[model samples]
Target: MARRNDHTREELREMALASAERIIAQEGLAGLSTRKVATAIGYSVGALYTLFSNLDDLCWQLNERTLSCLMAAIKEVDETDPVACLQGCARIYQAFAEQYPERWRLLFEHRSNTDNPLPDQLSTRIGGLFEHIDGCLARLYPRIDRHERQLRSRILWSGIHGLTQLEHSNKLFLPDAMTAEDIRIHLIDSLLAGWDKESHHA
Candidate 1:
């Protein structure tokens, strides 16, 4: 029988990440540890160190992965109509947060001091999303100045992020309980209404 290389470096790295996500999902970020990840993956702590320098590094990788997935979802939105594209983007953003609460928390909720520099690939991934939004705004109102278009895009993004964060934290209060989907749709409508008013004023 051929020798079994039960643990390659790449394989171990994948296992460590999977374990980290599992731990975060089950017990929240406070419960995640290198030792726990190693144990979960049947590897020693040293093995984890060989792949990642520290828990922060591992978490950074996980956050990057989460962002990549979010970007992909945003890119998948249809762009036929500017308002529809913005609404779709907003819906996708909230859906990601609701579906992967722990991962989303790590990505956008927590403020990390670690110098987890975003890789070029990840930067490009996010830039594409912004570019699509900008394109949509430009198409909707060709007369709008470049600076105003950028401002509107930023405002929309900030609105979606704020609402998603509030909803995820369960701190959002209305007359009645609102599902994430409902909140997403409401926010999109508000954004579009503001955009329409601005367009008419211009």
Candidate 2:
């Protein structure tokens, strides 16, 4: 086993995080432990402590990296057509959730036991998710006010998230009727069409 001094603090931090992610990916959040991470990185638990305050801090950092990956994935989608872009973004989000359920759950399902709110940086990064959706809505409906657009983004995301949980639990009305994405497509189209119809009637 390599001594802890073999690597710089930053390198050790990265190594620990990577090891932790692999452990979590295979066994879910409950499987993660500071000792496991330390052993995986060939370092002592004390050395791991130097990198993170506690397990919660480690999880927080893990979630931060996951969020960055998600945002980058969204940015990679072509946005020439806002409508298609919106649908593409939705699909990508769903794909990410399905591919990395444990990581995705770590972002949301895993919560710190502390009473203190999350770091402002993390809170702000989470807000970016909703803001991205808001921007997409602006392109689709120029006349929609910011407040309304923000609310719409939340509503749309809430629906998608709800369906995702239901899908995973096999709790949807029709067990094998359709995928969450299929229902999401119909839901999005119906909502968009309803808005267009409302405008016409107005």
Candidate 3:
């Protein structure tokens, strides 16, 4: 292992995070460890602790990186129409999950230690992803209250999240006729229709 003085704290943190991501990508969360990350980055496990509070902290940072990447992917969707915006974000989300099953799964599956909740910046990045949907719903229903729009965002996100989770676990294979995209489109359309009905009644 290299001496701690060999690398600045920022460089060590970046190196550790990069190594941890690769481990999760290749071997899943079960294979990621401070020791493993340190070894891969040619540093001591102590170096990781200096940068992160604990293993959970390390995972939290890893999730932040994943969220940032996911947000970038979602942001690429065009703002043509509300339905298209929702569908485009959903499609990009599914593509990200499929492309990096382990890394994507880490965002949802890894839990931070209850004693030390995730940092504020990490929470902000996670919330930023939802903001994209919230913005779409706001445009979709210009008259809806902010709170209502927030609820709509959560509802739509839940639908897409559930679909992807099921697809990832192969539970989406019960009926062989439909592809994942087919289900995704159906979910978005159905959600929009339901919201429209509710909006009309309101």
Instruction: Report the lDDT tens digits of candidate 1 across residue range 4-43.
Output: 2686878777878888999999999889889999888877
Query: Backbone clashes per model, in order?
Result: 0, 0, 0
lDDT string for model 2 (1-202, tens) is 6687899989998999899899999999999999999999898999899998989889988888888889899988888887777788888888888888888888887878777679777777789888888888898888878898998898888888887777766688775666677898988888788877866786
Q: Candidate 3: misplaced stretches above 4 Å?
A: none
CA lDDT, candidate 3, residue 156: 84
Cα error of candidate 1 at position 153, Å: 1.9
Q: What is the C-alpha lDDT of each candidate?
A: 0.79, 0.85, 0.88
Write candidate 3's Cα lDDT for 4-79 as tens digits.
Answer: 9998888888888998989988888899989899899987787778898888988889889888988988888898
Kindly report which residue stretches of model 1 are placed more than 4 angstroms away from their true locations once superposed: 1-5, 111-122, 143-146, 177-183
**Which candidate's TM-score is highest?**
3
Scanning candidate 1 in windows of ten residues, the lowest lDDT window is 1-10
Alpha-carbon shift of residue 46 in model 1 (angstroms): 1.7
Instruction: Tell me each candidate's TM-score.
Output: 0.81, 0.91, 0.94
lDDT value, residue 157 of candidate 3: 87
